[model samples]
Target chain A: MALTQEHIQQRLTEKFGDLVSNFETPYGMLSFEAPKDQNLKVLQFLYDEADLNFQFMTDLTAVNYPDKPGRELAVVYHLHNLRDNVRIRFTVYSDINSPDVFTASKLFSAANWMERETYDFFGVNFVGHENLKRILNVDEMDYFPLRKEYPLEERTRIDKDDQMFGRG
Target chain B: MTEHHQHHIKLPEGSIEKQTTTLNVGPTHPATHGVFQNIMELDGEQIVSTEQTVGYIHRAFEKLAERRPLYQITTLTDRLNYCSSPLNNMGWHLTCEKLLGVQTPKRVDYLRIIIMELSRISDHLICNSIMGVDTGAYTGFMYIMQYRELIYEIYEEICGSRLTTNIGRIGGFERNFTNTAFTKLEKFLKEYPAALRELENLFTRNRIFMERTIGTGPISAERALNYGFTGPNLRAAGVDYDVRVHSPYSSYEDFDFKVPVGKTGDSYDRFLVRNEEMWQSLSILNQAYKKVQEFKGAEAEVFHADVPEYYLPKKEDVYTKMESLIWHFKIVMGEVDMPKGEVYHSIEAGNGELGFYLVSDGGRTPFRLHFRRPSFIYYQAYPELVIGGMLSDAIVVMSSLNLIAGELDA
Candidate 1:
């Protein structure tokens, strides 16, 4: 029997029923969201389970959603099972006031820098990471640039003419 | 009195501790081949620990993409991995096409394959030759660079620029390939094999090169996976996973090729794997060219897709026709609305699986766009690979990994 999205979803729901929600297959990929605290549990189960061994951490990133009151930051994990050639996306939401998610660096060594990058840009703190500092940005930067609060352009720059830039 | 003092001061063997010296490789060094720093702590000549700092060339591309139109984002991808700019361009276009639900013609897919393979060859050529240069063998570097120049000429004939070739559009190519481009490609196919043979003869079995590279920076297959290794680096670690093979896109399934794998996952294995892949790319290029030639008349003339609102009109049409002029204005201004959905599309870039994860809220610009750079992923393991190794071996390991600073800090 081939590994399909339904099989993986069923296994996940059976283990942690109702804990994993918002299960949707967008463009044929299985994506779901879980609580921020249970991130390591879900990752461990996916890795240790015989049929669903998603050992390869394809990517780890964070998306900021300021409109959502409680869940302002969403840390997404893309995992791939090489044996079955299947992929699943898992996300965990964190509050803006205290954005802390458990570190997956112990499980996947690749998560070390990725978590730091997420912290650098989106300010999503990965608790228990050995070196949880900015990876790509200058350490002197006081604010997270990727957060929705900041504007894309430099606020201090006044030399540019708005009429020439089509803003007029 | 002096003899008594000396006898009294007799110390135990190994009492003195070895002092570790801290050395900075570069924010600008010749061996690093890019602007990045590696703070290495060394005990004598052996590396004890290493800390890396990137972001010297950080341009905030993702932030910029949030403001720019979809078509304008193609220019940003050019600077990501300049060695394989066309691959990035095609990957971005494929992502946009997926979001728009557009299907490109067969001829366009074949043309894309030819250009992409040529870019892949150029990328691997630079890496392998630079590996030779780092090993103190400059002849192979000089000999192989000429082929890279030829590939650039092919790019020039296809697109206007050579290095940063923004070669394609959303649905397909901006223009059809000219006859001169075909002639140049044919010449390249005929002459490159012999040049490659000579270049390989110089480095492949050379005892000095082998001794310098083999077992110098060996990463186990399991650890390589844990560190998110992909492309030639992961293949060198004995993993037979290629994005082109695993998830076929852009008509990759139509062609036949082999995914070269290596054992030991050392610098030597990486070099050999890249060399083998260049051969496979050449084979794929030949097959794609023949398949493209099979299309005749109207089929060959069709470069862009049938989607008028997305693809820009030709300059002549835009100048003469009112409807074309309006469509051109709308497309350039990003007034054309697309479906509201999120999509993650990846392509087999020269370095690895270069992916674009896009979130759309049915707006002119993307809600969020993220580039999954393989260089950024693989470079995190540098500290682990270099620890407990000789200082010189660190350089070999860095080169074999082919860490493009642009992609790393983007």
Candidate 2:
């Protein structure tokens, strides 16, 4: 039998107490928010515990909310348990000043590159990564591209007279 | 030298010398089906490390999908992995269908299974044959390529474009399986077994081919799982998991086939797994052909078929009926309200678990979409797989892993 959202909420609340926060959308999905410090604990439990072995980290992405004051960025992790075919989403919020979150690389090695991609696009720092460098775009890039505030249109105009020309 | 210096650092006495060499294998190389680059660090004939730099074929698909209407994204899905775009398109449509809470008819489901399995056969054929080509087995490559051509011909008969076929619609297929497609597929089905047998007999037991692939790039099942390996890569590691059997989307449940697993987790085992899977796909095609032949109908949905909100409203209906005209205008103007929710739908795409996770916030476009691509995961394990193998064998390892650069970069 598949565990419903209610069972997930009850089990999580009973296990972790106030460390977890449940956000219920109008849709049936229950977005579970755990404290940044407890992210790994929550993930490990989800993987090891009965009825919630979310062995697969389906996707990892970061969303930027520039308008939001306290929480300026959110890193979302979507996980799935192949056994029961159950899925759950976990998110952690951080502000721009020190936008840092625990890395799940130790739990799932696949998160290494994915977390780096998220960091490259959204600038959310995965604190424990050994080599936290940009994976997709070139280095020395000034800004994160995927943030809502960053316009997709090119913001910089090329200067015709800036570069040295080929000489005879 | 001092005792401390001897333990920490040392250098051999030699005259200062500089050596420079470079090798470019991409952008037009036959091995690279799409635009891809690999800059290799070399020490003479041996490669030190290879840096794969992609995105040359970057259509900016994710950004394009955000800007375009839901249906328009289907065209972009065609660009994700052009060799097997039908499966990618089906994955996108199935996600949308899940969001709409709509199900396709049983016949349409069978058609989807048949086409997708055919595409899988073609993809595996390319991977296996390309491995042979890279390993200098030209005859095997030609034999498999011949069969692949037959599959593409069948595809062209069904859809105008053979490579980038935007075949599946939001709720069902754009059209039924054409009679020509069915006949050609049936013919190919009968002949593919013999061709596959010939290739198998030639390569599977060949001493040279075995030495090139067997025990090369060996990865245990535990390591494969840790690295998030899927598709035949995971199967080669002795996992008995196939999304078709586990998830059973479309009419996969109705199909009678076996999920072939491997004993030794190596490139050779992966090759054997895909070889067995080809025969299994042939069985599926044969069964679907028999089932499709027995059916006698218009070959598509009837009442809900004319869904003006989702599908295109017919010209005749629009001219004759006011409601049809109004709904048509609404749909055309992008005023129809889609439900605000997220749907995660997956299918056993040719490679592996090709999942499309779409979050539609009651708008004309999805708020967020994610593709659970298989190559992306498998490529993450590339360094681990090829670290100890010879430089020449990297190509064979890559081919056995079936790393499609388009899908990986996308």
Candidate 3:
């Protein structure tokens, strides 16, 4: 039997019970948020459950939401089930100051470098990561470059009308 | 030197013996084919362990995509896995289409499949032939280079430029496929198979090639999945988890093709799997072309959809129609208001699942855009694959993985 969105929600809701919240099917993909601390527990449950096995870690990256004060960094995990051909988006948010979450590298080796990249960009420190040093940027680099504060350009050009573009 | 020093440090009588040699295979080594460092600890000729350092070619594509509008980001996608850039280009367009709910016509879909499969063939040809070159057989590369050139000529006919061809727009192609393009496609279809067969014969059954790659750098299906392997590398590990089959995109469902699988997950199996995939891609390309030819009259002329907001207006239309002139100005400036949505669209590129996770804040530019690059994910498993293997075999493993540094460090 193919896994349905309802079945996944039911199983997750039954296990996580009020822990996992914000269940949504944006663009027909099951998206939900788990508390930053209990991320591994939710992932392990999803992995161990025969019916809801999302073993393939398709992608792991971080998103920085400058507007949100408390929940500033969101680490998004795109997981896939090859047998059933189903994919789900799992997300967890942490404060920018204490952006520490348990690393999924123990369960998925794919998360090792991905988490490091997340750290490199959005500065989501994956707690318990074996080698969490800067992967992309140089070791001497101080600030995270992908943060919203860092503008791509200074925008000093006076040639074109800024109102013509969306920035106005 | 063995005597214990009391207060003062004594100089060693002889140089200290280092057991293992740390070898840097590349940030620029020819075997790597791109810029990325692999620090391998070796005991004589056998690898003890290896650590990889990427980002030498990091252009910060993801960072750049945040500020640019939809059409402007297409060029960035092209530079990712430039071997099959059309695949990434289409994937980005498809992601935007999904977010905006813009459906493309069947003719457009079929044409995209043809272009995509051609790029796939070219990419696989390069990878498989490079594997042969690494394993002491350079003749296969020589035989297949001309055929790859023929595929590029077809791209040139469609889009004007060859490599990094920003071929397709959001809804469909920039223009209709010309007669010259079809003739070039026919030429490629007629001639590529024989050359591909010859390249196969040069490497597949050769005893030396087989012995060199058969047992080197083998990974199990379980390990491959854990390491997030996909495309030919995962298939070579005896898993048939192709993105085309698993998640159909760009009317891939309309075409018929076989997903080739391999056992033992070694360099040789990877080579064979890629070769077979190229054949399947060719078959699919032929089927798509036949389907495209079946369209007649007005249906044949439909290159792009009726997306007045997105698609650029022609020069004549801009001159005559007032709305067309305004839309053209707006489109050029990238000022169209896009609906807010988060969409993850992936396509089966030459390598694996090239996923685009896009987040829109109801603005012209995307709030967040992440490319789930296969090269980046595959490179993570390199150390595990080549550990304890011969150094020469590691080169074969690298080529077989087909890790492009542009995509890897994106």
Candidate 4:
């Protein structure tokens, strides 16, 4: 049977004391918002101490909400522990100007590119990453494309005279 | 700890530094399988370091979904994993249906299972055939490609498009399974096993093929789990976690098939797992075809798919019925209402568990739609798989891993 949101919340409360702030969206997924400072520690506890061993980081991406101050960007992490067949969502919010968070690549090597992708798309700087660079787009591109404010159609077309190799 | 990246981070001063050459593998390369570019810093065929630059094929699908209605997203999903678009289409539609609390009829569920299983077979054929070609066994590749062509012919007979088949709508199939589809599929099922056996014999026994793949890129079950590997990649590591068996979506619980696993998680093991899975899929297909045939000539009840707002109308009745016409107009104009909710629906895709995470705000267009792509997850373990193996072995291992560039980049 799938883990009910209530069961998940009870389990979290039993394990983490008061660290977890739980909110249930109308959609049925339990959202657990933890402090950005205790992100890695809370994850370690969730994996090791509690049996919520979400060993697999299925996805790691970020969302940008510029209008919301103090919560301008959220680094969303989706985890699935195949052993118990349970899934969870862990999120850490950061400010827009200097969005830096600890890298989970230390815990799961699979987070290497996921963190880089989060960095590439949402511009959330992962502080302890060994190498963080653009993975999907050209490295020379100036801005994060997935951010809500990024202009998609502002790119100017190069003229024939400006082309170095001439028009095809 | 930092040996792989030291050369880029450190620099000796004004001394004449040697400038190494850079090789761009693809924005187009045969081995790449699609438009993906990898900028590699090469020291005479030994890669010092590599940077994979993807998204050349990113169609801004999220933006497109934002502009289009919920049901229209099915047409767009066909482009994501064209090799197995039916699975994606079903996943996307099921997510919406689940949000709407709609239950499809048993017949529709059976039809979905048949299409998705066939799609899985078609995808595995391509992955295994590509592995064969990468290992210099062209005969095996040709044989399986021929089988895949037959599968495509069946797909064409059913959906009108062989590759980009928008086979399913939001609630049920776009239309009922046609007679031509069943006949062609029955013929293919009869011949496909022999073709697969021939290809397996040709490649699995060849000494060169075995030598190239046997020990290349071996992964332990624990390591695979840590790396977030799923599907054949994980199954090859001795994990008995097939989504079809465990999650059992689309009435998959009704089928009887074995989840083939391997002791050693290597390229060779991956090959064995996929080959055996094709057999299991064939059995499942046979059963589905039988069940579908059993439902022939029944009085087609008014299509009970709950969300009439999203699913397409029947071509026969849309012209004559005023209510159908009005519903069609409402669907086209995005005036039909949907409840505000979110849903995550997944299925056993050819590669692994393909999930569609959808958020709807009672609007025609989805507020957010996220794809959990198997290739994207598997590719994260690429360096670990590729580093210890030789360059030639890297290519073979990559093929066996079935990392589709379209799904990865999207």
Per-prediction TM-score to the true structure, in the order listed:
0.96, 0.87, 0.95, 0.88
Superior by lDDT: candidate 1 or candidate 2: 1
Cα error, residue B357 of model 1, in Å, equals: 0.6
Ranking by TM-score: 1, 3, 4, 2
Model 4, which residues run further than 4 Å from truth?
A1-7, A25-28, A65-67, A151-168, B1-24, B39-49, B296-306, B320-322
Tens digits of lDDT, candidate 1, B117-227: 999999999999999999999999998888899999989988889988988888888888999999999999999999999989999999999988999788889999999
lDDT per residue (tens digit) for residues B1-410 in model 4: 65564446455686656676687877788777777766666655555656666778777675566546666787888887788988888888778778877788777887788788889999988888888889887877766777788888877776778888887776786666666877888888999989988878877888998999999888999888877788899999999988787667778888888999998899999999999999999999999877766664562432236566677677767899988988887776566666876566677888887877666667666656667788887777766776534567767877888877778877
Best candidate, DockQ-wise?
A: 3
Poorly placed runs, candidate 2 (over 4 Å): A1-8, A23-31, A65-69, A153-168, B1-33, B38-50, B298-306, B314-333
Candidate 3 chain A: worst-modelled 10 consecutive residues by lDDT: A157-166
- Which of the CAPRI classes, incorrect, acceptable, medium or high, describes model 4? acceptable
Tell me how each candidate scores on DockQ against the true complex. 0.74, 0.23, 0.79, 0.32
Per residue, candidate 3 scores C-alpha lDDT tens digits across B1-410 of 69986898677977767699999999999999999999999999999999999999888888888888888899999999989888888888899899988899999999999998999998999999999889888888987899989988988888888889988888998889999999999999998888888888898999999999999999999999999988999999999988888788878888788999999999999999999999998899899999999999999999998988898887799999998899888886678978987789898888898999998888888899999999898789998899989999999999999999889988
Q: Which is the winner by DockQ between candidate 1 and candidate 3? A: 3
lDDT (tens digit, per residue) of candidate 2 on B79-111:
666768888888887777778777677777777
Q: CA lDDT, every prediction?
A: 0.91, 0.75, 0.90, 0.77
Error of 3 at B350 (Å): 1.0
Which lDDT tens digits does candidate 4 get at residues A54-138?
6777777776666689988888777776767766778789988879899888888778878887888778899899989977777
Separate clash counts for every candidate:
0, 0, 0, 0
State how far residue B281 of model 4 sits from its true place (Å): 0.6
TM-score of chain A of each: 0.93, 0.86, 0.93, 0.81
Measured over all alpha carbons after superposition, the RMSD of each candidate to the real structure, in angstroms, is 3.4, 8.0, 5.5, 8.4
